[model samples]
Target: MPVDIPGPASSVSVQHEPFDVGAEIAAIAAGRPAIGAVASFVGLVRELPGCPGGLSAMTLEHYPGMTDKALEDIVGQARGRWQLQDVRVIHRVGRLAPGDAIVLVVVAAAHRGEAFAACEFIMDYLKTRAPFWKKEETRDGGHWVDARDADDAAAARWDV
Candidate 1:
């Protein structure tokens, strides 16, 4: 689900292809001299601990329009709470193998605190609030993933 958010220093999208982290970061900083700090987080697919064998891959799916909307809402919430100068979120969908990049979050602000907090906030909220679904593939078999309780707890800290 490709997202279209206009007139703000933010861009969010869900795609079926890999992203270039360096390029994305450069894009965020281009023409934005106000940004004094930048923070980034990249999520990768890997075998869950205790699994019989390593995870071969993961298949991610999302409801097109809704997925983009939900991400936009999250970015909006982060912007409202922080002094952010720019933000970019890119999440990949479709089939992906272990070691593949799954998500990228880049945030820029006037200070490190704002950049770090907003980046963490967006990733935490995205884990719980976003509409994407994931299924894991292993040598043994494959199964749809269940939400983690820890993710919920992570998001809860920002309730205030």
Candidate 2:
């Protein structure tokens, strides 16, 4: 059974298709007059170094239930920290080429501070905590990517 999340305050989806940032923003901002600020972050796939033949594509894989729960938990944490009006997270799976959109996080709040902080918080947690495995493809072949020190440091600042 699907869980019932009351109100239009939050949404999280994992799909293979691309999402329209403009449409997503409009949908979340609609009918919400109190929202004075909206902040968003879009992650894109780029060519990584050390690929002998250069990068061609990347594949993302995740377990259905686990991935959803992890994302929801991250969003819940962000909501607890900030007074947000709305939040949306969309993550793409399957094979994606260079320059493809990987993930989108949108946060709305009455103040720019809350919106910006919440947006970054959600992204930081998502990057480290989400259970997604990535394999980068090059002309030579594909290799499973590993977690980076920079990403860990980004998520560590939220520790209290």
Candidate 3:
């Protein structure tokens, strides 16, 4: 799918490489002179307490066509709501160890506020709407992560 923003130089990659915050920000801002500020967010796997089994790794699965469409829609919304120069989202799937990066979001805007807000909005929506399923691998076995009601509520806030 094509990126909605004009200044992004048309780059989007989804892979299992260890995510680097600095590299992602640089790629999103590359050759975009109008971008005065860039905002980025990275999500990582976390261990929870009181679980029956000890967490070891996480594996993510996503619907290809739907995932791409949802990301494109989120980016479009951010562009419409803010004067953003560019936006990019990269989400990794498959087995990931602890401290591994699961997702990265980057937003470029003329000002910091717009960039920050757009980045946040994309994350919020991704947490809820994106058709990505996660499997938590523990010492005992592996299980799919259930959808959280809290995530739904968070996305609902932007429904207007």
Q: lDDT, candidate 1, residue 13?
A: 77
> What is each predicted model's overall lDDT from 0 to 1?
0.89, 0.88, 0.79
**Candidate 2: residue pairs that collide:** none
lDDT agreement of model 1 with the native = 0.89
Per-residue accuracy of model 2 over 19-73 as CA lDDT, tens digit each? 8999999998999999999999999998877666988999998877888889999
Tens digit per residue, CA lDDT, model 3, 31-143? 87998999988898888576767789998887766776787777888789999888878888778888888888888899999998888888888888778899999988888
Candidate 3 has which clashing residue pairs, if any?
Answer: none
- Candidate 1 residue-wise lDDT, 1-160, digit = tens: 3444433544887887789999988988889889899999999998678897878889998878888788889999999999998889889899999899999999999899999999999999999988989999888898999999999999999993
What pairs collide in candidate 1?
Answer: none
Q: Name the lDDT value of residue 1 in candidate 1.
A: 39
Model 2 residue 55 lDDT? 88
